[model samples]
Target: MSEPLLSADAWTDRLFSDGWVKPSGGVIAVQEPATETVLTQVGRADRSDVARAAASAKAAQPAWAALTADARQAILLRAADLLVEHAPDLAPWIMRESGSVAAKAAVELEHAAGFVRQAGAMATEAAGLVLPSSPGKTSIARRVPLGVVAVISPFNFPLVLSIRAVAPALATGNAVVLKPDPRTPISGGFLIARVFEAAGLPAGLLHVLPGDAEAGDALCRDPNIAMVAFTGSTGAGRKVGEVAGAHLKKVALELGGKNPLIILDDADPDVAASNAAWGAWLHQGQVCMTAGRLLVQRGIHDAVVERLAAKAGHLPVGDPMRGDVALGPLISRGQLDRVHAIVSDTVADGARLVAGGTHKGLCYAPTVLTGVAPGMRAFEEEIFGPIAAVTVFDDLDEAARLANDGPYGLSAGIISGSVGRAMTLGAKLEVGHLHINDQTVDAGPHSPFGGMKASGNGTRISGPANLDEFTTWRWETVKAAATAYPF
Candidate 1:
């Protein structure tokens, strides 16, 4: 069978250019998750480069903001059209950089491309409300772009998280400076820059700098940036949030999650089992909002585990670029170690390996563990990999209590016979978003996405709610005829 991926020659000749010069510290090679091969090398950014990029964005932002919102909307609409055509190629880049599967990467790219169109259409909804007052008195409030915005994207789903900031910032007419994961720069910042340029966005408005943590620290602390959006670990998110607070700027912190999947005794075992397994294994369970802990009613835990095990076994584990691949490898050796350590620690602490927790090179098996105790790190920490933990509980109240035990509140799912109980459970959970009878991570573009508690700040990216995140409101109270300040 011919492997489906760009050849080394083709990658060098077509996928990228000499623009991304390698850094001295490391070449920042893009790795193929399925094959464990180096795809390409990209440059790294330091404080100097990041600051320069941010300054450039600040300089270009005014002109971009001056451009009519309709003009920006046209660019977004065009980007969406271009994305549908380029999914095949773009998907591979994401796979190489982010360790996302080709099929899943296509979803992220397509969503990213359409994000502009969707967000642009939301321009009409950007209108501010009018306050009620005297007759002939009118108050008009409008959303204005915050100048230069810094975006820091993590290794897991690098392109999607980066674009989460880029699409909105550009669509809303704010210039963006993107700081992608240092380990996976070529496929992220560089590729995204190319895509936007191909879509006809102004050059200076969008700049890419692949850099280390120091570069990120510089970006967050920059006074020129009016806003910042970050996606990664909860500890990292807190650090960025602290810097943002220091600057007194708007920051969107999309952090970690220890999301739970609750299966009621009366819920359909087959459906719950299938959904829980899929949720745990999708993208090899690297997603921040992945449902890592499975809490099933004792009445159905055994059945659910059996079915979930079968489902996990059936998922094809292979290279991400291949169409049939259901899961890919972790982003790097460090990630692999972290994932393995967590699973091992939990087992040592008395958890039983139910289905997975085995690794073959970069490919970690879709793991399912049971009999997890509260003392285990896996029980408290974010799994961030394809290891599912099944913990049995007797009742709905107890299930909810255990689900909300973690400091993270990114997302959670509930499967139950009663819609009322499901809704009630959703509210009781501390998560920013709850998935009822489904995966914790949402796929569609229309959904308002964010986390709550330690999982996130008041930041939503693409929905009607998200429109407000990228903009600052300005209210003008002009007289019906003419109003003047009384001196």
Candidate 2:
């Protein structure tokens, strides 16, 4: 067993700018969603703080970018090592702050570390290309870092989400201002700062400010910030894109998802049911890539639904810190109400509640809904809760239609014994990520992760995508230069 990250008497109360500093926007009470207890109070950033942070990042970026790639890589690799070393403490902190079960918390920590390491390796990758040019001496295109970037991450998987953008941005030679959701600031914001600080990253290269909408808006509108990387609800992402775009700043929006898990007739019903349950209930279905709808071929729909309901009914739900539970509480009372409202509305709209549609405090039980149709809320909306909305489809065409019907195209999965058939069906779906014989809720540190249509702006994060997201291209024409001018 590992000790908790923050002791009762010692709490993180400051935000990180050039160094740890008290914020001007007062403080936000960080609560344990499972128990509704105030775990700590963290400093909140207002517009003024955003300006200062942005200015600091802008000022530091040039010097940081000027460093050798090996130097930058060394720093990022150290940060990755630090995350692994601190995982015992950090995992428990994530479990408490984000309402993640122990397994999920551990997985998030692992993913975070992997992302940082991958980003570090990216530093040494080819940063430019030789271009074919008109009869000049030489021509080249080089990737240069954006001056300063604003990274806005959500609460559900805060550590992974925040680091996915921050690590890559830093590795690509950009400074970052991180705005983590206030709910899990410790895990989302301060933890990254601590890791980097321990890794000996220079001051002002990174800033972690836990703030509200105003602070985020300020970051988007701030003249000093060159780009914005956002991961959150579609509505919030749209706003960030709009504001950032109006300022002519580059933006990467990894938004919401109404992902689908399609179970074909050939798939084993019990196995498919188990996969669906894991995809829908992991981290209480708070993940953006969670299977929002389970579209089953009519042949196996009944059997799959039955097994899924049984699993949902038996899976444990409780405070993660207090018990070994399969599913933990939703982030807050408001989120719980929203999830319940969708469930109740879907049930009223003729969807059958097969099992588990109740709550104890903030902990909502794993719910299974059957007879869910296309128009029902359960089938269409991204219900960020532990509810499996099962809908029956007649054939491959119908399955494809149902899976592609939603506005979001973040992720989709097809479970079929025939890999060829699953791959064929997967190719037809309008999704950014498609998995054959697997669940929708999956991501890798080295994969290009993003969405399509309303889910995002088609900009990806991680792997090679980071080069495009965090940097811009500068085309340089050289040698015998004066003879090249035509104008």
Candidate 3:
């Protein structure tokens, strides 16, 4: 089926009877990898738009905060049900709008559904504990919503990533100002907003403002915005941190990752090879936790490399909407150029392209590289494309040590049959999440997802940890004893 094309005179943030307009339009716009149709524009937003959104958020937040968690949960659950009902509507847009393969888009929707359910359940149940400070002193701490939160999500994994922030923020009573990536806005925010509106959400609690940087900055730096949650690249994350810090607002930023995947000598060839292929190639390797580096023990390096290359070689790089392409285009041509530059520089630095370091338009084949060094561009940079670099190591200790060598410590994978080896390596590896015998990004709704070091700020997705990100703790020490105080 062909994607629904926008009307001739579409503009940014234009509201319609059905849904809001996507700013990206016409020829000079981001396109779907499958059919190469204009999905949205990469337009800019100014300070005024930000201020208006912020004002709206500030206005609507109190009513949202006044509602019980159970009430909020009910709304969220209704939204979840709506999402399931509209999966048919959503699936196409996700694929056509985000350049995501149908299968990957389905997985993303499933992740969104799971996260919504988890968040709904957590909305009312998410609470802080009362700690026993001293003998007679009551140290009871209660969790309170931060009033207003700003969520800025990227184009890749738009539905899932945006929801991961929105669910928790809404669940915790913070009215949200969401700025979805202009490149692929697609009703990711509108859907949530519609659900909230249907659930009798207060006027200003769930504002969806999808635009470019100036607008995003306004929301982040707004005085009324008590918290800011952003997920993007390292460069943008830093800017968000700066603005958020200047505002004295709490912020959680999940930035870039140049992840590593380690394969031990004892790992199964079939499992390790398949896992590594998907981990590196899925979503065209645009994942923040994509295995940019694959380190294999020297004893098994040759076998692992051969298997990995063969697997990557066999993987399809077809149209994303076909549900066949194991790979798709990078988010943009700019991103493709960056990946290309990295591959070129690595090749110049003596890395051998074992297979598929090539491209056609925005699409690139799943590539495998050998002879990568710590100092090379591919090793140092976040190659957010279907290019996996394999380097052989002599020992497990050496692999662990080398895995921790990079600046970005988002996530890492270990392929080993030895439980002890996997455990040891998992512990020692300097990353936020570690996987054993798995070659995929974190499957998280129950697990916390974030990175260590420069990979992220003090924020996470999923599990109990996510709800706490958009809130602050307020101590309410009631006198159950009816006494003055303890000294």
Candidate 4:
């Protein structure tokens, strides 16, 4: 038989700690969703692999933390440069493994590199605080790494999500045991190891273990792993949180969202439609902050819905390797099926399908739904696909209520000509990230990115905020005068 274009032989035996080595777990084939072709095979880690990785991370933590912050900063900056330099080689793998278009692949790589640089800058920005003390006594409080962190990232935007957590954990002087979703192991797992190693990171500092749920559970339950940083669905996050809580481990979660985008009466329908398309269809709407629900003012509801339907019809859904294709195949057949089922159910429940909804294989067309109301599955649940469900609001009060009614509070957006009006409405919506005259898909390397309530565990995971997730505070006090004890 002819060899596969991307072979398992290249990654099946790979494990990085102290350097690239072999893992004990066997391998599983990774398929390309666009063609259902075997793109490659990746090593499958088990509990023993997780234990070994955790041990390696724990062993390296002390020395890695002992290095001066400036030294660590330099290393991370170098890794950032290396990420950009190697992006071209890595982008194709990302495209094949995750079914990302060329443009989307490039964006993910760029954002990942920017994340590393931001984390590098954070290395020197803040350390701790000094407090005033009583006479003959000094008090100092500082942040320190939480020994080892276990990072479990999802398949969507695999490289960026994984690296964002990994970079910040490393920047804060903590070692990481990363468990990338098994489906995108090469780009999500082994590639991270190569980049950091090329940047001269020490051995045993970062371990990449590509595995399934069992591996993730083992990582979460490991006593040596001081904390867990995860980005995935709320369902999976809840299970992870349960494990972490049972073991009393620190955990940070970036979970699902059923976000909203509101259009004011005075807003331009064309502008709102443009923003809606960008926010709802980017990355095939697989993003946690995708604007799945749109609240349009009654005055412009029909016009905005028509414009969005036209936009959806025009988006190209084809092979991700093609330059003209805007929407690509989903990451797996399961996700494609789930999205299609939701769209079907919503339509059966009286929601109007204004535009595309069917799929050919894993490629689903950009979909738009109208006449969706409260108490309906389409309006209440998260559709992690290129589907935008629209509802009309009579006034600002109703719009704010509809926006805040959902269980998710990850992100929301408003488009209004008046800045004051937008601000007022934005204040009333309960969300972690709010955008004015924009869409809910906005994110930046230095931005504090996360959600509130079920969307997250009260932790933000970008810029300096991420440091809090990976480290703990220690207070020290010294007394120059000997004190007499009651004992």
Candidate 5:
């Protein structure tokens, strides 16, 4: 008989602290969202376990910081190489655990490797600045690592989300205690540990804990942790920020988005619809930057809606691990129910269900609704599912207003034949990322990524911004000798 892909023999079922060990909180069964089958059981960490992990991280951080920059860079670079080398094994684990299609899983693996490599390259960059000072003295402002960082990542795109923070934090010389969502512990937590372990990271410098809200809350409040980096929903991010703030800890949040995609009158209906369809339904619309609202100018509204609806209906939906499909399934039954409720509620509120509004088990058909107004549930809420609610606007003024109406300001896109017009309209929207002539669902390894308003705090992540996220500024002054003071 063949062994399981992530067998206990090949991977530890225990959480990593000082070492891989059993947790006081027993174990949680990690399920495959598409089939609703148990993929494996992983150790769950409790408050006590979080305490131990935080202590381990705090103790080991100084040594990690003390290492030469080249030493740290080498480990991160090797981890990136290892991730690419292990993609065959790792991609399947991500697909089975996260219900991502083969293509999406592949993209996640590639992006994660890029993020690690970017961090490795950043490690050797200048870490401080020299400034003008009074005569006979020198002033230097240096970027120093936060003592220990706690990372809370979500289940969707688990590998990419977790590593984006983990690699940069480690590269900046901070120890990390990562709490991945319980649903995707293997890809989010275990896979990271394995790669860094193989890269020869020092023991106690990195810990992976798969736990529930209690464990996460405990991690935020732990005294030893100096910062918290979180990627999840807005409600959860608010709680994390509040708790972490109370402890005077620096927090970096990449939260939810009800992102908008605007189609101008001059845009080609087919091309605009394609961009909207890809943005809204990609990965079953589980991405944080998924286009939740599609605002089309009145001149092209009907054409765009018709094309988008047709595209949504034709896209395949099934178990991705078994065969080729555009989308797999929602993360769980609860998520599926929430998505359906929003769709049903929106449809009932007089929005026309143009394409789909049905589900079988956890797989929801890509859905589209037209005549969706601002007050509708689908228009206001972040329906993190395969549903696209589109509304019409008479002019660019109304379009910008509609796009900016929602509480979220994560990502927005403007599709127009006139690039200047799109740029003019996009500049007015209160979003962190505004793409001209493209979709909102785009990111680069070196691009600064985050959200605004309810989507996230003002802080950013990735690229050169990581130095700011994982480190603090320290100022020092040197003098030829102690200045003599007169009383």
Candidate 6:
């Protein structure tokens, strides 16, 4: 059966900064993953276009920052309201471009909108405290916007990931020039620009440039852009950091992860297996916080693996628009082939495929593997697919060791019958976010989400911390009378 079409109004190629602009360089044909059809065409912005966007943001920053905090807050709140009003139109674009199922797509829409509202609240809390100073003098510190920001986002979870930076930047009075991944312009960044524009954001405060990596490089190198706020792979983030660092520009990075999920011996095998399925198979495991490593205590390893394999085989996989399907096609053929290649290589190196290591086009079957050890590519790398590798651990120490052995330390999950034991073990794990009696893949607009070590650049992205990422603090002192002076 032919899948239903996405909303008609969103199918266009125009770009927006101060206003809608026609494409001058090239065009990018966005393909629908489920049907392999050309869903829409977006502008492929070049270096010159990026420079123009940066300049526009620079020009708009001061006026935006000077506005009353309540005014800026109202605009962002209106943008949030607009998102909910238009979710039906926007959700389809998310599904068509990012290959997200309806449920996940709805979550993305609501998360994006909720983030904007939360950011508005953060704006009211951006004030600093007064400190003690010399006699007859008062000292104070105040938080201020960091001028223009360049936001580079990824394709998976396009709406929330992109909005995660943009909404915070704007709420803190910083203008932003967003360069979304070419594969997901409409769903990722363009809708955000439209909502803010309708909500009466000043011209040039929020710009959406749909293009490739070259455009992102241009934004990073531009002097007018005060900082770079990025969400993507660690490999690409390293390059962005290098450029921004060389120019002495501030940067906030939310990068990759190799998350671990541990199932204690006392836990129910069926319940643990079901949670594992949800963590590893949602959106075909494309999430940065997906549970890539499964560590099970020896007593329940065999039984849990059996149940997990059975769950993998039972999940419905097909078009994302289908109500019954649990798994959807990957974003593109390139991703599909990359995931297949990793699975093939790991299976060749003694990793036993307990259930599935197969694919029919972009829909790779939910797979479960056992005996995955150190040094194997699948064990060491981020597969970014619906594949879970299990490792048997003899004790809590062994489980913690296996979990923290990997380079990435984004998130981890512990499943135990005892809450005290789970909390004890959770403290030992070297991850930024820990879930007690839950799966690893989780996030919320009000939560301060990021990672430790290589997972992020020592900066927070959501909640009140988001305001700190996009703004700087300045100290001031006022003397009531002239005391002794050095000059």
Tens-place lDDT per residue, model 3, 1-487, is: 2232333244343522123433321222546765556665433445655666677778877887887778888888877776776677678777777678878878887888888888888887838787888776678788888888888998888888888888888888888888878676664565556655665666766666666677777877788788888899999999989988888988888989988888888888778777788788888888898988888777777777788788876877766765577777777778888988989999999999988888876788888889998999988888889888888898878888889896788988888889887888788888888887786487678988888899998577778787668778898775557764687
Per residue, candidate 5 scores C-alpha lDDT tens digits across 1-487 of: 1222345544346787776788999889888989999888889999999999999899999999999999999999999988888888889989999999999999999999999999999999999999999899999999999999999999999999999999999999999999999999989988999889888999999999999999999988999999999999999999999999999999888899999999999999999999999999999999999999999999999999989888987888999988999989899999999999999899899999999898877999999999999899999999889988999999989998999997899999999999999988988999999999888899868999998999899999999789889899999999989978997
Which candidate gets the maximum TM-score versus the true structure? 5
Q: Which residue pairs overlap in candidate 5's backbone?
A: none
Per-model CA lDDT versus the true structure: 0.76, 0.91, 0.77, 0.87, 0.91, 0.87
In candidate 2, stretches whose alpha carbon ends up further than 4 angstroms from where it belongs are 1-12, 134-136, 480-487
lDDT of 6 by residue, 156-202 (tens): 99989999899989988899999888889988978887788788998
Please tell me which model should have the higher TM-score, number 1 or number 5: 5
Q: What C-alpha lDDT does candidate 4 achieve relative to the native structure?
A: 0.87
TM-score of every model versus the real structure: 0.91, 0.97, 0.90, 0.96, 0.98, 0.96
State the lDDT at 222 in candidate 3.
82
Clashes of 5: 0
Candidate 1, superposed: residue stretches over 4 Å from native: 1-27, 124-126, 133-138, 480-487
Q: Give the lowest summed-lDDT range of ten residues in model 6.
A: 1-10
* lDDT by residue for model 1 (1-487), tens: 1233233442232212123333333335556665677767555666766666777788888898887878888787776766666667667777766777767887787777666667678654545777776777877787888888888888777766777678877877788888888766655576676666766887678877766788788888887898888888889989999988898989988888888888888899999888887778888888887887888899999999999888777787766665567888887777889999999999898888877777777888898888986778878888778988889998778888899886878888998888888888788888878878776777456777888888888687666766688888998775658657797
- lDDT score at residue 47, model 2, on the 0-100 scale: 97
> In lDDT terms, how accurate is model 2?
0.91
Which of the two candidates, 4 or 5, achieves a greater lDDT against the reference? Answer: 5
lDDT of 2 by residue, 1-487 (tens): 3343344343356788987788899989999898899988888999999999999999999999999999999999998888888788888789989999999999998999999999999999999999998775688999999899999999999999999999999999999999999998889988898888778889999999999999999999999999999999999999999999999999999999999999999999989999999999998999999999999888998999999988987899999998889999999999999999999999999989999999999999999999999889998889999989999998888888899997999999999999999988988899999999999988979999999999999999988788888889999888774753677
List residue ranges in candidate 4 displaced over 4 A: 1-10, 480-486
Model 3 TM-score is 0.90
Task: Please list all clashing residue pairs in model 3, or write none if there are none.
Answer: 24-40, 24-41
TM-score of 6: 0.96
